[model samples]
Target: EKAEALGVPAGPERSRLVRGESVTLADGRIVHPDDVLGEPVPGAKLVYVGDASRVDDLVEEARGADVLVVEATYLEAEADLARKYGHLTAAQAATLAREAQVRQLYLTHISRRYSEREVLAEAEPIFPHTVVAKDFDRVRVVKQQ
Candidate 1:
């Protein structure tokens, strides 16, 4: 009801669309998919990616999104674990963001075992503008400059 009041569709149009997922990294850090996406809040539309296999669903739903919040939970060395846990690494998330043509990409749901510097280092090579989310940080997404 609140989401509707703020113009977010009460439900996704596609039944196959994902709302979120959970996973454990090779380093033993646990992450829930929604944790990466911040909160649903009142205004934003959400299309969760429950697992990596659902990349197609993510791509389709993310089309034209002004802001795309994704996860880079692996370091490629742990890609096997990434697949096992259903999360994407920095490269994968950036690829999806590019393919979907989203205006901005915010990477989230990181393994807490890593420092903020490490996370940024892992994500920057792929997504130039990627920002690792910090608690209480505010990101304003307006349509245009």
Candidate 2:
């Protein structure tokens, strides 16, 4: 249903992209954690970037995102703990957003350890437009004037 709205082609090929192996997917392939895929929108495309092991790929995939939905589950104060958990601290995520030149960022998958206020306080400094996502909340991405 969502794909139809997005005009993404339906098929197994659109399910996931095979990493490490180069793929020649048509426009609209939706890339999964392991597979690459995209939805259709004329010349628009979606690329998949994997984990820290594939950090370069992640950066490339975020090249021109209007909004980047990123996870900043830890604080810089706990950098060691964050690395152990395979998560990024607020500073790291913000850096990525800035590097990618993303228009806006939405932070999610937050750790339950910090209160909402703490999360916002930690992230806001690193990324000026950052917001801590809450359950069942909706926010439209708006351009800054």
Q: Which candidate is the best by TM-score?
A: 1
Residues 45-83 of candidate 2: C-alpha lDDT, one tens digit per residue: 332222231133466677666667777777778878778
The residue-by-residue lDDT of candidate 1 on 39-138, one tens digit each, is 5455544434534623656787887677878877766567777888888876677777778877777877777766767766776776667677676878
TM-score of 1: 0.58
Each prediction's TM-score against the native?
A: 0.58, 0.56
Candidate 2 vs. true structure, TM-score: 0.56
- In angstroms, how far off is 33's CA in candidate 2? 32
User: Lowest-scoring 10 consecutive residues by lDDT in candidate 2?
Assistant: 45-54
